[model samples]
Structure formats: structure tokens, C-alpha cells
Target: MEYGEAQQEDESTTKAAYNPTEEDIIEYARFLGILEEEDAKLLFIAREGIAAPLPPEWKPCQDEDGEIFYFNFSTGESSWDHPSDSYFRTRLVR
Candidate 1:
């Protein structure tokens, strides 16, 4: 998959760091499917931005067509365009 460009701006909203232990791996494997060695879960979790493995299931991305596609969240890569900082404003009320 192709990745978009990264933009920078003032930000404070942070994503909490999470570490996955052995049990976490097992749970994640249960969701992503177990590998021959059951070691690929780490890769999958990392690919999914693995902010603490929680059941290995989450709302990974909201697509361009307004579809909620579920998958592993990759903190490394963003699947869509999101304001990386507070410079941009989000309008809630119409």
C-alpha cells in the first residue's frame, strides 16, 4: 500500500504507549491467526500501531467512503489523512 505524506504542526493529544506481554501475544494471535511459530503476532501488532493489545480487535480505520474498516492498527503508518497537530480545527456543530 502507498503511504501519504506526513504533516507537522503543534500537538498535545498523545497516543499512550503500550507494551504487549506473552499473554497479549497469544490474544493477538487468536485474532490475527496463529503463525507456524506463533511469533508473527508482534509484526502484526506493530503494523497495527499496537498501543497495548486489547483483544486484537479494534476499529482500525474509517475509510474515505465512510466505511468503518476493522483491522490491525499500525501506529507507524496512517491509512487516511488526519490532522497531525492542533493547528487544524475540527468543526463539530453545523
Candidate 2:
């Protein structure tokens, strides 16, 4: 196929359930100043599958004390950190 046709095909593709590709994630990471922050590595880890993604049922929240926490609605469990160490290594730098 020609380059123009390939580009058209890509543009015409529907993304009902869009998940960013590694290139997309890296571009975002770069825009976010990846080299200047530790938390930026988390994006790479998550996108590259080096770490597991957070469980869909688990939600992240902050307490009144301004600390991070994870709540698992499926199990009625809550914790100061993610249940999976491999999912998120540290608090998000937001």
C-alpha cells in the first residue's frame, strides 16, 4: 500500500476503546518532562507492561490528610498504598 493509503486507513479506523500506544505514552511522558521527574517513569512502566495495571474495581483517592490511598470496591478493602506493589511503585506526582 502507498503511504497516503496507509495514512487514510489509520485515520479512518474507529477507536471505540482507545488505549494509547507506547509511542503515544512516550510522547506524553516527554511533554510532561519525563527526565526531570521520578513519577514519569511510572507512565513508561504502565505502558510497557513492566508493571500491572490497576484493577478496574480499585479506585485511587486522597484522604482529608492529603495522603494517597486505594480503595477496592470489589472487596471492601482500603489501604494507604496500592494492593499490588507491581502496579504502582510510588505515589503519583500530581
Using TM-score as the measure, which candidate wins?
2
Query: On residues 1-94, what C-alpha lDDT tens digit does candidate 2 reach at each position?
Result: 1121111112113233357776766654554345425565457544543234456776555565555466666776776544665433343345
Worst 10 residues of 1 by lDDT: 85-94
User: Which parts of model 2 have CA positions greater than 4 angstroms off?
Assistant: 1-52, 86-94
- Candidate 1: the clashing residue pairs are 47-74, 48-73, 48-74, 49-73, 49-74, 49-75
Q: Report each candidate's C-alpha RMSD, comma-separated, in the order given.
A: 16.0, 15.8
How many residue pairs clash in all the candidates, one count each? Answer: 6, 0
Which candidate gets the maximum lDDT versus the true structure? Answer: 2
Error of 1 at 39 (Å): 7.3
Cα lDDT tens digits, model 1, 1-94, are 2222222211222233345666765554444444525445244542343343222322234445544333334444443322211111121111
Clashing pairs in 2: none
